[model samples]
Every structure is written in C-alpha cells, then in structure tokens.
Target: MQILEEKTLGIKSWSPEDRPREKLILKGRASLSDAELIAILLGTGTATMSAVDLAKRILLCADNNINRLAQLTVKDLVKIKGVGEAKAISIIAALELGRRRKSSDADKPAITSSKLAFDVLKSDLTDIPHEEFWIMLLNRGNRVVKKQKISLGGVSGTVADPKIIFKLALDELASGIILAHNHPSGNLEASVADLDLTRKLKEGARLLDIQILDHLIIAEDRYFSFADEGLL
Candidate 1:
C-alpha cells in the first residue's frame, strides 16, 4: 500500500490543471466533483488511497444516497476503511456545525403569516422520508419563539394528539402556533386525515387560547396552506 503523505499523495500529487482546489478557485465550487468536494473536507487519506478515493468509498457506503449521510454516526464514519477517529470526528463535527448554522439562520425571523411559517419549516421538512408533525412557537407579536417536532409517522396514519401539541406551546409560553407536516409522496394536497386533524387542532387551540395560525402540507418544492384556501 502506498502511504499518502501531505507531499506525495495529497494535493501536491495533482498537477495545477487537475487539482480540485485549484479547479474550484479557477472555476467555482459547482464545478467540483462530489469526490473532490468531500475530499476537501477529509483533507487526507490512509496508505491505500487518496482523500478523493476515500470520499468515493464513503458515498458508495451511502449507496449514493445523499440523505444517508445524515443517518451516519461517528462510529459509522470511523468504520469506513480509511477513516480514523480524527477524520470521523472532523466529518461529524462539520456536519453538526452546518446544521446549527442553518438552524440559527432559520430562527432569526419571526413567523407571522402562513407564508412565513412555511418558509421557516420547508427546508427541513421537505426531504423527510416519514411524516413529521412540527409546531412553530410564536410570541404575542407573531415572531418565532421556537420550533419543535411534536411527532413522526407514516403519511395518512400519523397521529398527533392536541394535548401533546399544547404542552410544548405552554412550555414555550407561545401565544400562537403553526402546524406543519410533510407528504412523503410529494403531493401537497391535504388528505382527509390532514383536514380532520387541522379542524380538531383549531377547535382545541380556540379553547386553550393558543391560536392555530395555519396547517401546511409540504411536498417537494410545493406546499398547501389551509389558510390560503380559507380552511383555517
């Protein structure tokens, strides 16, 4: 096995024209291959392969499924042939840091309307494989106080009790809330269960004085707002 030293098998091995970093600099990040993009994070590899090769192997382990990357734990990364503790920790830390950064950015704006609520939750909920019910907690002014996942299950069968929903709102001291759920089938239309749940929640919220602002059904790149349809 050829050991990959910083000088030998690292970025130094690639000619100026063939180097990923240089190519990214000359062109753009969009121009880089997936292996190159991952290799930049990996930094280096073991004796048997370069970082790019290691990245290719990692993607292969994911069966080329990008979402599978989210499922990977530190132990899973370390189990890969060339990924040691340092590399595994670095990768996991990078992923987590990115998630926190996105969440922080998402948390900045208050969700006043159904449109605003959808904007805040869409990015996270759109790609989910299963149905996830989330509550967007809002202050008296309608700015977002926090967002919390209330439950998860299949599309038509997911059940989220009003008590469970209200508990989090009470805990957060939220004056208003938005209910959001995803359709795994990529259909934004509300099911009968969706409408029933929304009606039930709105009735419950009215009694508790916690306003139900909207019920949004999210699919890929599309969404249905009950409020927009005068259903709220």
Candidate 2:
C-alpha cells in the first residue's frame, strides 16, 4: 500500500532537482522549458496528473505556438481539465505581463516623414476590424513621446474631438502631433469628414503653438497623407 501511495503522489515523486520551481531556481528562468514556466503559473496539479504534464497538454493543444497560447481566452483555457477560473486568470495575467514588458523595452523612434509614420503604425492598425483614431505625440526633436487611442467606433467612422486631443497634448507637453485613423473598408481615399477634421485640428494646434505634422488615413495595404499632398 505504501508503494501505491508513493506512486500516486504526482510531481512530488520526482527528485527535487527535476521539479519546475526547483529547476528554475537552480538553472535560472531562461533555462526552463515552456511547460515548466506554465507549470509554475499553475502551481498545482489535478488528482491524476502533474502540473508539468497538464501544461504540456495545453501547449500541444495550441500546436506549440506561443502566440496562440497568448491569444487563448479564459473560456478556451477552462475547456481543459484542472484549468479553472483561478488558473486561467493566472495564466492570462502572466502572458499579459510578458507582453507589457516587451512593449516597455521597445524604443520609440523619431517620425521623419509620412512614410515613416505609416511604417510605424501599419502593423497595429491594418488588421483591426473597426474604426480607431490614434495620435502620435512627439517632442521637439520629432522623437515619439507616446501613442494614444483617441476614439473607437463601428465599421463606418469614429469621432475625434479637437478639445480632447489638445488636452492630451497639454498633459504630455507635446511639441508636435501626427493624427492617424483606419478605414475598415480598405479605402485609401480621404473622406470629406476626414479632410474637415484635419483642417479643424490644424487650426486648433496653430493656436496652441503646437505643430500639426500630418493626418494619415490608413487602409488595408495603403495610406493617404495630407501633408504629402500639400493639404497640410
């Protein structure tokens, strides 16, 4: 009976050096496998399986793709046995922290032209399904201070208020600003409303002594630049 009990003790039956937490401490976090890292987040196993085994199953379900694992919703995670709400939340929080760490470490580059602006923002805006207006605030040397989402709306259009924009500019002490918005329809032409808003924002920025660099209309694979067209 002692042998049976010992056999059923799951991860504890392994040597201490083989345990995920113990291995991480001995070899440093960078040396641990993906399953071991997830096992640490889970912290415990089910009655029949070890935490590492469960983590391995989860990774296999994602086809060993880290991005697919990161995109898993809590509902999707809880479909697996032993991954209750608490465990699901823990996994999600860990993934989000990793994403934020990468974003914080990335250096914001200077915006030199409309082409550069498109290159910087295309990846973020191109695949989004709905309309979103974003602002890139810059310092005196054209280095990006921050990127902020101003508004979100349906497939048609979104609103961008001049007062709210300048408020953020005031808060960030931005010397120059570039406005960008996406068209979900994949149309690169600027709408009448788009041109009107650009003019209003330009007039407003001039009053505040802040330079309005350009207004960009982002589509699926192309963009329209107001400054490049001599509209700014």
Candidate 3:
C-alpha cells in the first residue's frame, strides 16, 4: 500500500463540494460524518498525515466511537502522531464547545420528563472526575429557572444539607427542583447515601412548599432517575 502525504490527502485536495468545512457551510453540520466533523476542527495534521486521517486514527483509539470523545484528555490526544499541542488543544476545545452547545440547546425547552432531564444533565455531570451536586431550579410552570453547581466534593462525599440545596431555589422563588449528582465510577445505581439524601431533600422541599421533582444519578451513557424508578 502506498502512503498518502498530508497535503495530498487533505480537504484542500478535495473539490469545494467534498471538503468537510465547505460542505458544512453549504449543507449544514448534520450533513457531515463524525470523522468529517472532527477533521474540520482538527484543521490540519503533520506533514505525513491528513487531518481527516488523524481524526480517523483518534476515533479508532476510542474504538471508532464518537461518544467516547468525552472520555479523551489532552494527554491522551497528544499520544496520537500528528496531534501536537496545538492540535490536541483544538480538538479538546472543539469537543467541549460542542458539549456546551448541546447542553444549552437542550436546556432551552422545559424538562417535562425523566428522560429529558437525564439527557440535559448526563453530559455535564457523568464525566466529572469529582462529585458535584447540581440543583435544577424550576419555576411554577416546571420550566427550568437555572441549573447550578451548588457544591463539589471528593469521592464518597456526602452533602445532605437541604438549606444549602434550596437556598438558591428559594432566592429565585422556584416552585420545584431536581437533584442531580454523578457517580464517577460510571455505575448508574444509586447508593444508600443517594437514597437518603433524596429523601431528606424531598421532606425539606415539602415543608418549604417546593416540590422535589426528581433525583438523577448520572453515569456515562446511562442514568438513574428516582421518579422513573418510583424511588422518589
């Protein structure tokens, strides 16, 4: 097999219609393949490899799984040939920007179901290396007022203070809230501490006339909903 150099294999070599960036501009982002989307962000590769080829190699490192991009770190990315510091930073930044954009778009609409709630919070929470407690404050109409990270803690951390969780909600005059936390181990199962914390929050919310809509335990690619499982 013959080796194709970067310049020969690059999007620059393709007709404008075939280039990922040009195609995206003409046809929209949804028209691009995962590799094509990634290649556009990568910009270029080393002299020996095209950006698209490098993107394919990077995706293959994650088992050709686009979703696994969330799991990649800058260190992991730099291990790839042709992915120097600048390219690695660009790739990671692009992925994070996409994640933030998706979250913002998804959160624009009111979360009406457990599934929708899970979808909005999973990406933000599940990959967190440490425990984070997020309070999703909702208006009387059940539309989200805001989602705030109330606290960050260590492994096996516990945050059971209803006052801490509800202070912001009360300040915003929120009628309801969802409690969300992540299990860094990627197990969606709720621990005893999780159950206890939810129960306490429910009681506190009830006393304050604020509804506890749900408690979501987020993990990679999966989540546990207290309301969905009849635990709340």
CA-lDDT, candidates in order: 0.79, 0.86, 0.81
* Preferred candidate (lDDT higher): 2 or 3: 2
Candidate order, lDDT descending: 2, 3, 1
Residue-level lDDT for 6 in candidate 2: 46
Q: Counting only residues 3 or more apart in sequence or on different chains, how many pairs clash (N, Cα, C under 3 Å) in candidate 1?
A: 1
Model 3 misplaced stretches (Cα beyond 4 Å): 1-11, 25-28, 105-107, 155-160
Please give, for residues 1-232, the per-residue lDDT of candidate 1 as tens digits.
9986654356667786567778889889899987787788888877778788898898899886655665587788888899888877876677667555655644367665667777788766754568888888888988888888888898554778889889888899989989988888877878888898999989988887999988888875578899989998
Q: lDDT by residue for model 2 over 1-232, one digit each (tens)?
A: 4554444557877898888899888888898899999999999989878999889988988888776687688899999887899999999899878666644515767889999888766655655568999998899999888878899989989999888899999899999999999998888888899999999999999999999999999986589999999988
Give all candidate RMSDs, comma-separated: 5.7, 5.9, 3.3
Compared with the true structure, the alpha-carbon lDDT of candidate 3 equals 0.81
Question: In model 2, how large is the Cα lDDT of residue 142?
Answer: 94
Candidate order by TM-score, decreasing, is 3, 1, 2
Q: How many residue-pair clashes does candidate 2 contain? A: 0
Candidate 3, after superposition: displacement of residue 164 in Å?
1.7
TM-score to native of every candidate shown? 0.69, 0.64, 0.86
Best by TM-score: 3
Clash number for each model: 1, 0, 0
Question: Which of candidates 2 and 3 reaches a greater TM-score?
Answer: 3
RMSD of 3: 3.3
> In model 2, where is the ten-residue run with the lowest total lDDT?
1-10
